[model samples]
Target: MAVNTSGRTTAVDRAYSALLAEIQTGALPAGAVLAEVEQSARLGISRTPLREALVRLAAEGFVVQQSPRVTVVAGIDEKDIRSLFELRRGLEELAVRAAAERGDAAVFTALAESFSAAATANPGLADPAAHAGYYALISAYDAAVGDAIRNDYLASALRTVHTHLVRVRQLAKDNPERLVVSAGEHALIAGAIAEGDAALAAHATHVHLHNALISILSSIAGSSQTSTEGTP
Candidate 1:
């Protein structure tokens, strides 16, 4: 059944979307407790709808039930990150190959040009405004891939995976250098797709994923080491 805006169901959707965004963006950090009453008050929803939203998040693994009354945000560690990338490399490689074979050359060519421009602009994403443009370009390219692949199941699965990826991306420390390299990698993928070369696009996607996983892992490791050294 579809929910309209006038019912309690809408409240559940509202609460769910708000909480999900906070968790994905790290505003609600892992292990942060979700007290039902407090959340209801904060989100301006009734307790019943907040509870429904909490249940939805728990079912999706965004939160964990710690006790009869305690619910907390879930954490992503190194092992989880490795597992995530392993699945990503598989799904995304297949997706790019499909996209390369089926995508409109004009669409991909424009995306490629946009990515090239982004690289030249060298936004580095150091400022909040710069971050928006950089991420918007990446989102546009991913949306193009989803449309090109034309697989509902794969697209749905990838959406679920990407929700987790937003959190994983936050774990990495800011590195303007990496963002430039990433833009180039994206250009290669878009270019290969524009050329209608499935094998080449798949190869480029694989290389991109391999490098991205390495970079994110390295960033996490560096952060951990620095934290450990600073602790008594």
Candidate 2:
């Protein structure tokens, strides 16, 4: 739900969004320590609300609280990434199909605008900063499609995917070409939706996600090989 005209978003909500944004954007990278006292001081909120926000984040898999002094940003391991992408692929396929079948011109326009923003943010290859902006653009695209679909279950599924998308976005940034491919895929998906080709849109989204997974896995494999080669 969109926030009201009132500028005051709740403290806990604000804190949660802020922390999640930091973690999602890699500003608070994986395995980084999180001190509630420091965060409360930085955000100008009380420990009570910060704790509440942390609890919510933890429940959502952003942070893990192994112990009081050992809470850290959760890392998306290979298995986790694969699982999240699998779920995302399924849900996004459904969302794209619905959007294609039922979404209006405005929805298509919104998706096109988001793709333009992402392309502008990542002209060729995506660096860390460029990728962060691209992720924001993709989130907007997802939100636009979710709203166009107007299904509560689809929206819920997209929410889960978005959480893991933050991490996947970071990993993909390591391979700049993937950004170009992603932008192209978004354009194709948007075009399909605009034409009301539900089947085409769903198929395009699935292919896009599968290509992304392959690229990321390839990058990871190469990194491992390099590390092994360098070992004493």
Best by lDDT: 1
Per residue, candidate 2 scores C-alpha lDDT tens digits across 1-232 of 3333577788888898899988876778788888989999999999988888888888878999768688899987678778887888888898888888888866786677677556555343355556566656666677779888989977977886777675555554265666767877887888789888999999999988888888777776656322110000
Question: What is the lDDT of every predicted structure here?
Answer: 0.81, 0.75
Q: Model 2 Cα RMSD, Å?
A: 6.0
Per-residue alpha-carbon lDDT of model 1 for 1-232, expressed as tens digits? 3345564558888898999989977789889999999999999978998988888788878999888878999878899888988998889988999998989989999998887776678334434456567788888998999999999999987888887888888778766666767778899889999998989888888888888888888888887522210000
Which residue pairs in candidate 2 collide?
A: none
Relative to the true structure, candidate 2 reaches a TM of 0.74
The positional error of residue 136 in candidate 1, measured at the CA in angstroms, is: 0.3
Report the error of model 2 at residue 90, Å.
1.2
